[model samples]
Target: MFTAESSFTGDFKLVPLKWAERARKSYPLESTSTAKAVNYGMYTPESMWNKCTYVISELLNECLVGSWVFAISPTAADLSTIASWISDILVDSASLVLVVLEWFQVLSAWEKTFGMPVLTRQDSEVTYSIVPAKCYWTVFAHAGASWQAKHVELVTQLREKVAIRKAAAANKQKRPEDDEDDDEVDARLHKARKRPQKNENKMQTILPTEKAKAAQQVEQPEEEEAVDICSDDSDDGYIYSDEDYSE
Candidate 1:
């Protein structure tokens, strides 16, 4: 049995209740604040507590018997009887609490035996007990720890595969409008890419014509200058220039 005590510094401690103290008085009888904190089976009568212990013992017996029977029989255990016993235990609030606390103790014992640290708080750091490295390592690798690690890895991989399957299924279930939207996007991209090539081809076709027109304009101006030079030479060659001016 555990008793809670608060120190002057406001720290809480769980002290084991002495047999005298545990048996001195029956579970809290009054509706006081302290009494309210205690659960139904926590400080109850010895008979009630013993009943809970007996139920646990019976469960262990069932497991032992079932294991032996399973070696010879195809049906390993009487699942109905086991389930009935569990239901009977859980029906009583005190019995349920006892089972939970007992399970916690079992876990603590296993952790101690396996050199694993018992977690006491939500934010507690998990570290191994001080033991030989090789010994603990061998125990952990060979025991259920390795199997649990592999199980977690497999579960993670299964979740990833499930997510991938869901995404693929969603993609496959696309609406016709979605497909149309995708096609429209592809067409727009194709057009955008082709526009620059079309402009380049147009420039290629237009450039030679523009160059020919420019060359024609330049040659026309040069031909006009040559004709003016020829006419001036012919007038110089004519000897009636002075007589023409007098007339």
Candidate 2:
């Protein structure tokens, strides 16, 4: 069960109720504003308030049963404050002023149960409470065993959804990095295939093959000239005989 105070402060926005005239004509309600006021007043009426309480209690019981079933079948529990709040609201309808007030208590209970801090306006005076964690889980375990199979199925589905979402996010994050690596590899391959081969061909062409051959031929003539000059040189002016030259 839950208890909460209503501190929601805001101006009401009037919606033009269609069939306002027809409804008034049939029901003798004085005006649309009167009808609205009467409807609002019903929650505060003692008899009507008890009926509302009963309904809220039933809802809370159902949430507890469902939550218990869900919690025990799986090792994991829903730490979501919303789920806790729903459970609390079901049990504590007597304390809720309006549906909105009920929601606030449920949220507060959830936060408190999960060790989360509550956020409130500086001027607001809202607070909530529920059973502690160990007792809560123990109660859930006791109640949940009967509905274990269904609870397991529900939790499995939820976990699968979470896993799928996480995987999709990981893939989304990795896609760009993969693309960047591919671009770099492609750029390197393209440079290797296109640019380096052309440079190698240009290098081959630039080598001085013709000039080297020409230089070799010119050096051969110089060497022959030096040999002839050496042979002709002598202190005496007389030429050697053919036999002496052969020797």
Candidate 3:
């Protein structure tokens, strides 16, 4: 669950989802306010192991039945039943444990995905017992038994990666260097989340168009008055009559 909590200092931090969300959000242009940066998953070293325990407990019943069936007939354990039984699964840790504990050829594909086992003593037992190192989460995380044997060195690298992811999640929650404003950061995130307006009220900018071309019209012919040759007696060199010249 994406749970939230507050400390005595009145500062609140979110959990589990926080880690995953924060890691993803840390990318460029993908960030929100870091004021509450500590909220990421509470995946501390101790808690990681405990989380694994929870995962084991949930799969405990299915693993037992499936393992036993596999011991008898490898194909007898139905994966559908395993899927229906488990709710949440993380990492391939628990499946590896059963592989190490017994060299039984069982399908751990189910565990490649779920979470926890609780510490409960047998009804007849008088005291609580600590889980053995062999039963530790690290040992389980390394459980990658397949139809074929893994090289002795390959297991070491796989376990290292599991440990690194847990550690990375744990450390990523520490207050980052950015001391950004909480309110502004929240506002920015809220703005980013909102769907863009289909019709923004912004006044459309009308771009200037090319200048219109000069218009063309027919030119009317002007009437040319006839010059009378006989009117040369006038003070002017030529005398014009109102009548126009004939073709």
Quantify all predictions' global Cα lDDT against the true fold.
0.33, 0.35, 0.29
TM-score of each model, paired residue for residue: 0.26, 0.23, 0.20
Clashes of 1: 0
Candidate 3 per-residue lDDT, tens place, 1-247, comes to 1112211111112114444354312111112111112211212122121112222232233232122211111122231111111111222222222121111222334442353222222253422111111222333323333211232234445557767988999887745443456667988888876635322422222222211211212244567999667677868676666473552
Q: Is candidate 2 or 3 superior in TM-score?
A: 2
Model 3 deviation from native, Cα RMSD in Å = 19.4
Selected candidate, larger TM-score, 1 vs 2: 1
Q: Which stretches of candidate 3 lie over 4 Å from their true place?
A: 1-162, 171-209, 213-236, 243-247
Per-residue alpha-carbon lDDT of model 1 for 1-247, expressed as tens digits?
1222311111112223566675322232222222222132223232221112112131123211112111111111331111101111111212121221101111243365768644342234321111110112222333432433443344356556767988998989979999999999999999999999999999999999999999989888543434342245554575445567688
Off by over 4 Å in 1: 1-175, 217-247
How far is 134's C-alpha from truth in model 1 (Å)? 27
Number of backbone-clashing residue pairs for each candidate, in the order shown: 0, 2, 17
- Compute the lDDT of residue 209 as modeled in candidate 2: 82
The best-first sequence of candidates by TM-score reads 1, 2, 3
In model 2, the clashing pairs are: 60-90, 85-106
**Candidate 2 — worst ten consecutive residues by lDDT sum?**
6-15
